[model samples]
Target: MLTIRPATSADAQVAYDIRREAVRHHCIGAYPAEQMLAWTAGTAEDGYASLMASHFYMGCIEGEPVATGMLDVNAREIGAIFVLPGYMQQGLGKQMLAFLEALARNLGLAQVNLDATLNAAAFYRQCGYVGEATALYHSPRGIDLACVPMTKVLV
Candidate 1:
């Protein structure tokens, strides 16, 4: 069984590892190698530590953290929902998304939005997010990646 819990600075490496695996393995079909590499290069342990400290970032753990999700209440956005490549297609992503949405509802958010990578936009759509437009997102190193802006209203 998978359990969701608050992530800490200590889990930074786990989060970083999962994001790297997911981006490297699953996103190749949608993005070129250079862009993918740039996106993956954007985060590190310190980045995740600040994310955990500022937002509602959670981990999905069985024996270890195999998935992570971030919900920024101030932005009302769902950020960086990722599952380890080996753990894909196991419904972990859906569960984390539901948890984020529920948190948004409880926080009095009327809607939640995300900048979904081209590779992940379909998955977000499957979870009820409507794609608004395709846009360019800049990486930390200033590489532009194609992304879809998506939103889902809380009912």
Candidate 2:
């Protein structure tokens, strides 16, 4: 059985680990390898603390975090929707998205925005997100990466 639980302070490291793995290994984006190597998801000084500050969700099967994502109510955004490799094609991402969208609705956010990784554009499209714009985002160390901006209105 899959369990979607409220992320606690102890989960910060694990969530950060998942996010880092997705960015460095799984991502098929315009981000350069040089930039990817520098990604130290919240295990570092700056971003880890910030990540620890956000509201996050962890999807566990038998208590292992196989999928993770977050919703930032203050920013009206959904961030870091990722499923570990073995967990792919199992509808975990869609479940995470639906849960986050429901949270977004409850938070009074009319729309939720996220920067879709290049590989995930098709999936996000399948999930009913429309393109908002495209941009070159600077990853760690100012490495520029192509990102598709997308949004889904909750209304």
Candidate 3:
């Protein structure tokens, strides 16, 4: 069973590790080695601490965080949804997504958008996000990645 709760600043390192591991393991064939390296380059100082203290949530199983998700209420965007490699295909991603959508709905958001990575587009599609045209997502870390801009209507 997976339990999710708001993440604190102290969970920054764990979140960073999960993001790095998920990107490295699951995004292998979708992006080139150099691009992947650049995508996962920085430490949690790259805004994770603040993010955690804000809208971030960690999904844990037996008290071990195995997934991460964030909903930016102001921007109406879903970001940083990643599940550990070992936890993939177990419906954790879907659960986390549902949780985020619920949060959005409770906040009276009409819609939520996300720039889904190449490897994660299909997953987003399966979860009811609509959008297919690929776009170049300029990461805050100074890397441009091909991503599918997707949105889900909550209203």
Candidate 4:
């Protein structure tokens, strides 16, 4: 069973690890190796802790966190949705996304936006997100990643 809970500042490193692992394992063919390396090089201090204390959440199965997602309420954006490679193809990502979309609705948002990684665009599309043109997402950790700009209207 997957149980999701709000993450605290203490879970910063855990979130970071999950993101790194997911990107490294699942984003291989979508991005070049060097870009992926730069993207995942940073530690939790980069900003995971603050996000954890805000709207970050972890999805745990049998007490082990295997996925992460974040809802930027202020920006009306959904991001950081990642699942550990071992946990892929089990519908965890969809569950986490549905949870976040519900949260957006509760906040009175009519839509939510996200920058889907090249490898994840299809998945978001399958989840009912409409995609715009591909764009470069400049990561705070200093890497430019190709991403699809997507948005979903809550209905």
Candidate 5:
């Protein structure tokens, strides 16, 4: 069974670890090694500690966190939606997205946006997002990642 809950500081590292696993394992073939390494380089405890103030959700299966996502309310964007490698293709990501969209609707957001990873662009489209041209995002670690900008209207 999957349970979704607001993430606290105590769950920071757990969420970070799941993000790391999702990147290192699932994103390997889609992204070059160097890019993946740069993307995941700062997924440490302190980084996630700063995320505690944001609207983040941790998805757990029987009390173990296996997925994580964040909603940027002010920006009306979805950020860092990731499911652990072992938990992929099981509808967890979709469920997390639905949960976040519900929250966005409650917040009166008319639309939401995201820069989808190259591998995940199709999935976002399947979820009703319309994609724009691919763009190069300069990661915080100073790496350029190709991403597709997408948006979905909530209203």
Candidate 6:
């Protein structure tokens, strides 16, 4: 069984590691290896710490940090939803999504938004997030990635 709980700064490295695995192993088919590796390597402590401190970032796991995601509670923005390759089909991502959605509801957020990776567009759609737009994400280092901007308005 997987459990969802608040993530701490100490989990920064683990979250980064999970994000790296998700981008490489699961997203390699959609993005070039070089671009993916560079993107993953560029993310580290500073960003994750700030996110844990302010947002509703939660880690889901059976034993360890198998997945992590965050909700920008005020804006109801969901970010960095990742499930390690081996843990993908086991429903851990769903568990993490549930936590973020519940947090959004509890916070009285009227809507939630996310930029979904190519492979994850369908999943987000299934979760009731309509595709509001498509974007060419130009990384700070100039790597271009395709993303679908999605939104779900809550009652």
Top TM-score prediction, candidate number: 4
Name every residue pair that clashes in candidate 1: none
Model 4: per-residue Cα lDDT over 1-155, one tens digit each: 78999998878999999999999999999999998898888799986667887789999999899999999998999999999999999999999999999999998999999999998999999999999699999877667899999999999
Off by over 4 Å in 1: 42-46
lDDT of each: 0.82, 0.78, 0.92, 0.93, 0.88, 0.78
Output the lDDT of residue 25, model 5: 85
- The whole-model C-alpha lDDT of candidate 5 against the native structure comes to 0.88
lDDT per residue for candidate 2 within 1-155, as digits (tens), equals 56888887777777777777766657745456765666543473445535556778889999999888889898887887878778788999999999999988987889988888777888899999989567876655455667798889887
Q: How far off is residue 33 in model 1, in Å?
A: 0.4
The 10-residue segment of model 2 with minimum total lDDT is 40-49
TM-scores of all predicted structures: 0.91, 0.85, 0.96, 0.97, 0.93, 0.88
The true-versus-predicted C-alpha distance at residue 69 of model 6, in Å, is 0.8
**lDDT (tens digit, per residue) of candidate 3 on 1-155:** 99999999889989999999999999999999999998888899986667887789999999999999999888889999999999999999999999999999998998999999998998899888999899999877778999999999886
Query: For model 6, what is the alpha-carbon lDDT of residue 58?
Result: 49
- By TM-score, highest first, what's the ranking? 4, 3, 5, 1, 6, 2
Looking at model 5, the pairs that clash are none
Q: Whose lDDT is higher: candidate 2's or candidate 5's?
A: 5
Q: Which stretches of candidate 2 lie over 4 Å from their true place?
A: 28-30, 40-45, 138-143
What clash pairs does model 2 have? 42-48
What is the TM-score of candidate 2?
A: 0.85
Encode model 6's per-residue lDDT on 30-111: one tens digit a residue: 8777767777875656365556665635455555778888887666688889988988888777778877888888888888
